[model samples]
Target chain A: MHRIVAFFLKQYPFFLFLLLEIVAISLVINHNNYHKGVLRLGVSEVSGTTYEIWSHITGYFSLHQQNRALAEENARLRSQMPDAFKASDRKVFVRDDTVYQQQFEYVSARVVKSSVNRQRNILMIDKGVNQGIAQNMGVMGSDGIVGVVQSVSANYALVLPVINVGANIFARLKSNDQKGIVSWNGASYHYAQMKGIPGHILVEQGDTIITSGQSVFFPEGLCVGFVTDYVQSPGDNFYTIRLRLGVDFNSLNHVYVIRNLMADEQHNLLKENGDAE
Target chain B: MQNSPMLHIGRFAALGFTQILVLNNVQFGGYLNPYIYILFILLLPLRTPPLVMILSGFAMGMFIDLFTGMMGLHTAATLFVAFYRKRIMKVVIGVREEDYLGTPGIRDLGPWRFFYYAGAATLTHHLLVYMLEVFTFINFWSVMLRTLANSMVSVVFIMVAMVLFERRRHG
Candidate 1:
C-alpha cells in the first residue's frame, strides 16, 4: 500500500491530467443537460455580450447585401397589403366578427453569433426573454425556417438551428400533402435528409418542402427546403430523401422568433386528452 | 524575457477573441473550421509544469467553449493537446531537457521541428474533437477527412503566425 502511494505521488501530474480530461469529457457527453448548468449560464452571459459587440463591428461589412434583401422583402410585403388591391363593386359587406385572430406574434432579433460547421450548431441572437423570446419558439429567416429557440437569458437567446443534428422539423411536400421529418446528417449545412415518405410515392427533384403547421411551434407553409435527390434500397419501405435547405446558414443575420399565442391552450388541451405530447 | 505571465495572459486573450470573433465565423466550403486557438498550449514554455500546462489548456478551451456554446468539445480536445504536448515536443525536438530553456518557437526549434510538433498536436486534437462531435463510428472516414483538412489549415496558419511573431529569441 505504501509503495502504491509512492507510485501515485510520483505520477500525480499524469493522474491529474487524466482526471481533468475526464471531467471535460463528461461535460461534453452530457452537453444537452449541461445547457442548464451554472457554467453555461455564466459563460453565455459574458460571451454573448462580447459577440454582440463583435457582430456590431462586423455587421457593417455586409450592409449592401442586407439592404438589398430587406428592400426585396419590403416590396413583397407591400404587394400583400390591402391597399395594393382595388376595391370590388356592388354591396359586398365583409364581417370580421371573431373569424380571425392573431395566432402567432413575431419578435425580430439579430443573430449576433452562429456556427454551421459543428454537428450540433447553435446561434445566439440579440433578443431574449426580455423581448418575449422563450424556449421552443420557432425562428424563421426571410427565406425559410432558421431554427428553434433552445435557451433564453435576459438579453440573449440560443437557437438550435435546422442544420444541427438535434433539430427535427416536421415537413410536408409542396406538391402533395405527403409528410416527412427533416433532419440534419451533420455532413453539410446546406443539405439535410427527409424521412418517412413511402417508397411508392412519386418524389421528383426540386419538390419544395415546407413546415406542416401540425406543431404549435411554427405556423404552416414556412419554407423548409427543396428535394434534391432520393433513394430506395430494394425491399425498403421508405425513401431516403435529400434536401437543399432554403436558408443560407453561413450568412444568417436577422430572424424572427415566432410565439404561438394559442400554444398554451393547445398544449393544455393536448395534455388533457393524453394522446399528444 | 518573453515568458512573463503578463505576455501569456495577453496571448491567451488575443487568441481567444480572434478565435471566437473571427475564426469561428470563417468556414471553408461550409465545414472546415481551423481551430488555431490551441496555439496557446503549443506556444507554452517547454518546461512548464504538467499541471500548469493542463490547466491553461483547459482554460483556453473553456474560453472558446463559452463563446461557441459548446461547453466541452473544445475543452476535451485542448486538454488532450496539453497532455501530450511535452511528449510531442520531445519526439520532434530530440534534445536533452537542459538544452532548451524556453517555448518551442520557430527560432528555438527551427522551422521544421516546430512544424512537425504543431502539426502532430493539431492532428491529434482535431481527431478527438471530431470523434466526440459525431460520437459514432458510422462516419469514420468522414471524421478522418475533417480532421486532416482542419489540421492542415490550422498548421498553415500556425506557421504563418510563428514567422510573423516569433522572430526574437527572448526567454
Candidate 2:
C-alpha cells in the first residue's frame, strides 16, 4: 500500500488529467440523449435577463447598421411580395396555406458574445425567453439564417450559429431542388458543407441554397447561402456541396427570432407520424 | 501542494477566459484560429496529483465545450493530451518534478526543456481536437490537413508565450 501510494503520488498530475477527460467524454456521449432535462423553461429565463443587459450596452454601436440592414431587407421583401402577386410564383407553389409568415412578429436582438474562431462557435443573443423568444425557433438577420435557439433564459437565448460543429439545417439548392444537411467544416465562416445531396443531380457555382422549411423552424424559401464548391465522392451516391451562410456570424446583431405560429401543431403531427412509422 | 492547486486553478481560469473572449474573436487567413487551451496541459504543476490534473483538464475542456458547442470534441482532445502529458514531461524535461513552483514553464524547467515539453503537448492536443471535432461525420483529408497546419501554428505561439512568461517571471 505504501509502495502504491508512492508510485501514484509521483504521477498524480498525469492521473488527474486522465480523470477529468474521462468525465468530459462521458458527458459528450450522453449529450445527444439529453432530451428530457434540457427542454425545461428556466434556461430561457436566464437567457432573457442576460440578453437585456448585454444589448443595453452594445445596442448603441450596432443600431445604425442594424437599422440599415433591416430597411434593406424590408425593401427587398416588399418588392418580392408584390412581384409574387403579379406573377404566379406565389400562387403556384404556396397553395399550402399551412405556411404562416409572421416576420412582423420578429424581435430584434443584439449579439454581445459570439465564438467564430473555434471549431464550435456559439452566439449569445441579448433577447431571451422573456422577450417571447423560445428554444428551437429560427434566428435570422438582414442577410439570412444565422442559427437556431439552443437554450433560453428569461432574458437571453444561446444560439448555435451556423459556424458551430453541431449546426445542421436542412437546406436545398434553389435551382436543382436537392436537399441535404448543411454543416460547418470548422473553417471559412464564409462556407460550410452540404451533404447527402444526390450525386446524380447537376450542381453549379452560385446556385442558391435555401431552407428546406421541413424542420418546423425556418419557413420554406428563406435564403440560406450559395453553393461555392461541390464534389462527388468516388463510389458514393452523394455530393458534398459547400454553402456560404447568408448571415455573417462575425457581425451578428439585431437578429429576428422567427416564431412559427403553427409549429406546435406541426411538431405534434410529425411526432405522431414518427411513432406510426 | 496547497499553493500549487491555487496556482493551477487561477492560471487555468485566466487562460480559459482569454481563449473564449479574445482568441475566439480573432480570425485571420479566413480559417485559422490557434488553440490556446493546450496551455492548460502544457503548464500543469510538475508534481501534482494525476487525478487532479485530469480533472482540471476535463473541467477546462468542458468549460470550452460549453461555450463553443462542439458537443464533446474539446473534452476528448484535452483528455487525450492530459493522458500523455507525463510521457511528454519525462521525454522533454528528463526529470520528475519534486519541489517545482506553480506549473512547469521556463522558469521551472529552463528555456530549452520547457520548449520540448510544451511543444509536444500542444501539438498532440491540437491534432486530437481537430480530429474529434470532425470525427465520424466530416471528411478525413480536410480535417487531417487542418489539424496538422493548425497544430503547427498553435505550437509556435505556445513556444513564444512560454519564453515570454518565463523571462517575465524569472528575469
Candidate 3:
C-alpha cells in the first residue's frame, strides 16, 4: 500500500492532468441535465450577444441567396394558400414544439463548422450558451427540419443533423393520419426512410410527410419530407417509405434554433402519469 | 542567449492563430476542416520531453475544443501524434539505438527524407482522428471518403507549415 502511494505521489501531476481532462470531457459530453450557476449564465449571455453579432457579419453576404429562396417559396405559398382550407381545414397548433405548426419564433443561425459528407454529420451553430439555446433544441432552415442541439458554449452549439444514422423521430404523412419512424439510411443527406405505416394505407409517390408532434423536440406539424419513392417487402404488408428532405443541407446558410418554455414541465407531468413510457 | 523568448512564443502563436483564422474557414464543401495547427506537435525541439509534448498538444486541443464544442477528439489525436513522434522519426531515418537521442532536424536528415518522416506521422494522426469521430456511425464507405478527403487537405497544409518553419531552423 505504501509503495502504491509512493508511485501515485511521483506521478501526481500526470494523474491530475488526466483527472482534469476527464472532468472537462464529462462536462462536455454528458451535460444534458447539468446546469451551471447563474454566474456562468451571465457570462454566457454576453458571449451570446457577441456571437450573434458575429453570425450577422458572417452571414450577411449570403442574405441574397436566402432572399431568393424565400421569394420563390412566397410565390408558391401565394398560389397554394387557398387550397389549404379545402384539404381537411388547416389548423394552427397551440404548441410550438411539433411539426404541426406553420410559423415559428426563432433566431437565424449560421453554421461555422459543418460536416455533411460524413456518416455522422454534426453541425456547429453560432448560437451558443448565452442565446437561451440549450441541449436538444430543434433546428430548421427555410426548407425543413435541420437538427438537434448537442453541446453549447457561451456563444455556440453543436447540432446533430437528421441525416446521421443515429437520428430517429416520430413522423407521419401530412395528408393521412398514419404515423411512422423516420430514420436515415446513411446513403444521402437528401433522403431518409419511414417505417411503421400500415400496409393497407394507400401510400403514393410524392405525398408529403411531416412531424407528428408526439415528442417534445417538435410540436406537431413542420414539414419533414415528401414521398419521393417507396418499396414494399416481399412478405411484409407495410411499405418502406422513401422521402426527399425539404432542406437543402449542402447549401445551408441560415437556420432557426427552437426553444420550448414548457418542455421540462410537460416531461415531468407525463412521467408522473406513467404516460412518458 | 541569441534566441529571444518573445520570438519563440511569436512563432507558435502565429502558426496556431493563422491555422484557426485561415484554414478552418476555407471549406470548399462542408467536407473539410483542416487541422494544420497540429504542426506544433511535429515541430517541437528534440530536447522537449515526450510528456511535455503530449501535455502541450492536449492543452492546445482543449482550447480548440472549447470554441468548436468537440471535447475529446482533438486531445486524443494530438496526444497520439506526440507520443509517436520519436518512433516516426526512427522509421523515416534509421536511428542508432544508443541514446534516446534528441530528434533529427532537417539539417541532419534533409528535407527530402523528412518529407516521408513527417508525412507518415501526419497521415497516421489524421486517420486515427477520422476513425474516432466516425466509429460510432460505422458506415465503411462514408467514413473512408471523409477521412481520405480530410487527410489530403490536412497533409498539404501540415507539410507546408513544417517546411516553412522547421527547415529554416537547420538552414
lDDT of 3 by residue, A209-259 (tens): 888988777767888899988888999878899999988777776788877
Per-residue lDDT of A9 in model 2? 87
* Model 2 TM-score, 2 decimals: 0.75
Each candidate: what lDDT? 0.87, 0.72, 0.68
Clashes of each: 0, 34, 13
lDDT of 3 by residue, B1-171 (tens): 213335445655776656544565566555677777666666566556556766767766665544343446566666666766777877776655432343344545567665666677767777766666554455666667766778778777766666666534432
Which scores better on lDDT, 1 or 3?
A: 1
For every candidate, what share of the true interface contacts is present? 0.79, 0.52, 0.16
Model 3's CAPRI class? Answer: acceptable
lDDT of 1 by residue, A10-69 (tens): 999889888888888888877755245345655677888988888889999999998998
**Pairs clashing within candidate 1:** none
* Worst lDDT 10-window in candidate 1 chain A: A32-41
The runs of at least 3 residues in candidate 2 whose Cα sits more than 4 Å from the true structure, single-residue gaps closed, are A1-19, A32-104, A117-120, A164-168, A175-187, A194-204, A229-240, A273-277, B1-10, B38-41, B49-55, B69-84, B96-103, B135-141, B167-171
Q: Which candidate is the best by lDDT?
A: 1
Which candidate has the highest DockQ of all?
1
